[model samples]
Target chain A: MPLNADQAHYLFSVMRLAVGARVALFNGRDGEWTAEVVEAAKKAGSLRCLGQAAPQLNPPDLWLIFAPIKKERTDFIVEKAAELGCAKILPVQTEFTNASRIRQDRLQAHALEAAEQCLGTYVPEVSDLQALQALLKGWDPARRILWGDESLVGPAQTLAGLTPGPWAILVGPEGGFSEAERAQLRGLDYVTPVSLGPRILRADTAACAAITLWQSALGDWM
Target chain B: MPLNADQAHYLFSVMRLAVGARVALFNGRDGEWTAEVVEAAKKAGSLRCLGQAAPQLNPPDLWLIFAPIKKERTDFIVEKAAELGCAKILPVQTEFTNASRIRQDRLQAHALEAAEQCLGTYVPEVSDLQALQALLKGWDPARRILWGDESLVGPAQTLAGLTPGPWAILVGPEGGFSEAERAQLRGLDYVTPVSLGPRILRADTAACAAITLWQSALGDWM
Candidate 1:
């Protein structure tokens, strides 16, 4: 198993990991595995795979579609998506999107970092920014969008009640879902309008809340 | 009811909430009630209580106990706790707690801001920093501690499965629960060890996850 230099520094120096120390490794594709350091250096380290520690637990085929916010907040969402086991992350640009574009590579790095920090076995794919219309036009019916919307005018539904399948969560930008975008989403057959609860959760909070709700309802938790 | 400067600015500038707008306010102790903006000032605003719109839905009497992290992350926890319907937020000092000290005033402000943003009637109180032992010493039988711990060595449990009552969620620092702290928690009768899931969530993530789980299991969602 290979670990980047950042991981090496974290394990060797900050965490004081030594040669022969057992470590866990997951490539998002493989299940959690145990590895022992064969060569440990401050800046570099090598680990030989020992055995599979746990069978791969695939995240529910859920994608998180959100309007990219500020740079740091967007980065935060990406990291959290990886930690929470979103299968994919699509940064959508809405009318109120504060950010013009996103650095996909940097976001991907954040996802990797979040995965490493949480000892997660998965890293959700971070896609390039797409216009809301473009994403909606291309959304696959097999994978539906559980829109994390706030303007719904009724009692919120629990994720527990939703049937498990290919699902994704949609969270708007700080300004919230525009009328046109909301109308577009409401018109889509693949989009399920769901509110997290009575309170208005921020985009980041909504993202995490939706993931947990989905996990509790359909993912491994149930 | 009083709206802080930032909230006033938001109401006047951002949302353009005009005078006499019907709003609601809750101070945790009082139930949620409708109110009208009696005075709309750019820097501050006052409201006149109309009546209780929604009778006090006391937060299962849960206390959110978490280690002090960075200012922003800590603030995030406080804000989310208020919106998640936590009654109180206690900043705990643990072995791996890296932050200098908890900013009670700033944190309290965050809670209030969160309440205003979510249109929530109640605000969760931000408590001063207390050592873990000090907190345990004062543990009341009436209030159980729902430890949002990640190291539980068994099948994961859901908050949706729990019966709501007086409870506190203990979120460890970024480094995680100290070995000694875990041992102490496991030995406590009032401590209920619940897992968010198999994934290792950050302290902030764990806080929100636990609250969501608790609400789904036993709060107003019931």
Candidate 2:
């Protein structure tokens, strides 16, 4: 397979790889494969696949839906979601969301980088910023949403006794979910309100913590 | 009580607080208090305590000891530790730890800011960087240490069945613990090796995840 300029530079200059060096490769769909460097150059390179190293290990059917915050922190959410084995990442613009738009390409790149960093065989897809209301309108009831409710802040209400199938963890913005949004979420049958802990975690920390809790209770972490 | 120059700037310049404005205050000892700004200035300020807002709620006796990574990430670890209800933050120098030193004052400031952000009444203390071996040598057998063992990376080994007492979570550096360090930790009676999840988590992510797991299982979050 042909390597991109950035990949070529990373392999040749950064990693100091040359011809005949074996590199692990994954394409989201295919399992990890051992590829030999056929041609290595400053800005271009090619690799020949030797054999599959490991089977593809996709994350459980879990999505991370969060209201985007600052640029760096939003990037952090996406990166951590990928590292924590999230299946998909959706950045929603809630009533209290400060950022109206997000650079989807940048966040997607962050997910890819996080996957690479964690030696993940698959990279979770990062969706563009969308309205939380619209997403809720078309929400799949089969997929349960674990809403991080600030009002329930105290002891963590564990995911115990809650059976997991298709699930997503919803984290609010820095300003927190509006009253109307909270009411709507509470009224929904599919949305389960959960508390992180006694302290009010920042949006980024809440996202990661929620993911950890879900994974440990109902997802693949078990 | 008198506010320092930085606190004065934070109140008058950043927060735009004026005389007669009520502000919540905590000294990590006394409970949170409602204070009115009796005297406000550019470089100096004073407040008169009106009443106590909330009782001092200290986190469970939990410590987060980690090998410092990059500068920004180290700051992140301290901030999250404070937000996550860690009683103390300790930076340790391991065999593979790249950073030899850490700014104790800056990290302490980060912890304080995190406490403020989280509305925490108590701020976790950030200790100066020290050698991991020295820390282990003086380790208390009563306080069990949950080690983030990378070798057991696939699936999180739950903290269930482990009784809670004084406990600490130890996260390794990016390069992971040296073989000698791992052997030493494995042989220690007080150390309990645990896995975060399937993927190779970055040091910062591992620290937060480990703390979450501990909190959910045995800490106040339960």
lDDT by residue for model 1 (B88-120), tens: 899989889987577789999898888777666
Give per-residue lDDT, candidate 2, residue A134.
97
Top-DockQ structure, candidate number = 2
Instruction: Assign candidate 2 its CAPRI class.
Output: high
Looking at model 1, residue A28 earns an lDDT score of 78
Cα lDDT of model 2 by residue, A11-128, tens digit: 9999999999999999998879999999999999999999999889899999999999988899899999999889999999999998888999999999999988888988999999
Every model: Cα RMSD to truth:
4.5, 1.4
Model 2 agreement with the true structure over B133-186: per-residue lDDT tens digits: 999888889999999999998889889889889999999999899999999999
User: For model 1, how does the per-residue alpha-carbon lDDT over A1-222 read when each residue is reduced to its tens digit?
Assistant: 556799899999998988899988887788899999988888887899999997776667888989998776788888777877788999989999978788999999898888878777778889999998888777678887788888862335876667678898888888798898888888988788887766667788788878878877787666
Candidate 2 docking DockQ? 0.85
